[model samples]
Target: MKTAYTAALSMLAGIAVGAVAIEGLHAQSTPKAYVVSEIEVIDQGAQNAYLPKVTELIKSSGGTFLARGGNIFAVEGEAPKRVTIAVYDSFAKAQAARTSPEWKALAPERNKAIKVRSFITEGLPN
Candidate 1:
């Protein structure tokens, strides 16, 4: 959980930094700055343990968990798991958090405990 929160805080910080960068770029007539992260989490039968830790991590980082799988509206896969999508302010910060020591500490058990898919994207002005 601490890891997620760290990432979230990083996201918030990154957004703030991006805003500053964007404002400066605008002064020079540059493009806007933005970052997007799509994260998916899967666990067959250990949500009880996985969620609590993740919850703690998210809370610490000031991350808002956008969606968590609720009452089975539908099932398309054979895997029994849920998905959690969280949005951070920017890709840079999110990546930083993911690679940070705090998050790395959780790595030892993270892989065995759950499956995580993360996508980081930066938005360019059209």
Candidate 2:
């Protein structure tokens, strides 16, 4: 009876340790989300007017800019005039930022001035 009880406790302890290890691994493996925008300035005047407001809105929504208005070279496909990359805490946050009231209010201005192709992608684990 003693041996049986000890064996059961050992098994439970092993399972607990294994569970913790798996959870830790999962946390480490979680990926971040990136919001990428490819923009073409159809009307430079209008785009210049609209950019500052939207840039502030994005910053308020927990977004960090990785790249903005830099040189882009196309390896295979066509490249847009400007490429913007922003990282959010998660996919949900990225979605929320796009749909936020402040961002929505500026949509008309952006649409009038620039052509934008934007998407969210899962980034590799750190």
Candidate 3:
């Protein structure tokens, strides 16, 4: 009887450990956020100069570019000339990256060169 009781307790402990591991995996697989920007360049020369500075700033803030300067085919409405998407760990991180001082300083040049509409959206879970 004692041996049977010990085996049952061991099984319960194993099940509990497995449940905790699954929870950890689910947390790690939580969806990230993307910072999407649609840009229309008014002055190509100024836009060229502005691009590198903001690119570096985004990298420094732990952002990864998922898409940059890609052609867009809009079926519903007018299409944007250029689109850039940057993925960060979370929505808050994406917001901080855009609002960081380094990025802010480069904003005027970017604004002068291009009209930008930027927003953040939650990414699909892996």
Greater lDDT among 1 and 3 belongs to 3
What local distance difference test score does each model get? 0.58, 0.89, 0.88
lDDT of each residue in 15-113, candidate 1, tens digit only: 999999998766454222222222244454554566677667755654556666653444565533455555454555556656667777776556656
Q: Which of candidates 2 and 3 is the stronger one according to TM-score?
A: 3
> Can you list the residue pairs that collide in candidate 1?
1-53, 1-57, 2-57, 5-57, 5-61
Clashes of 3: 0
How high is each candidate's TM-score?
A: 0.49, 0.74, 0.75
Please identify model 3 stretches exceeding 4 Å from their true place: 1-27
lDDT of 2 by residue, 1-126 (tens): 999999999999999999999988876677778999999999989988998888888899989999999889999889789999999877878999998888888888999999999999988776
Local error of candidate 2 at residue 99 (angstroms): 1.4
Give the number of the best model, judged by TM-score. Answer: 3
Deviating ranges (above 4 Å) for candidate 2 = 1-30
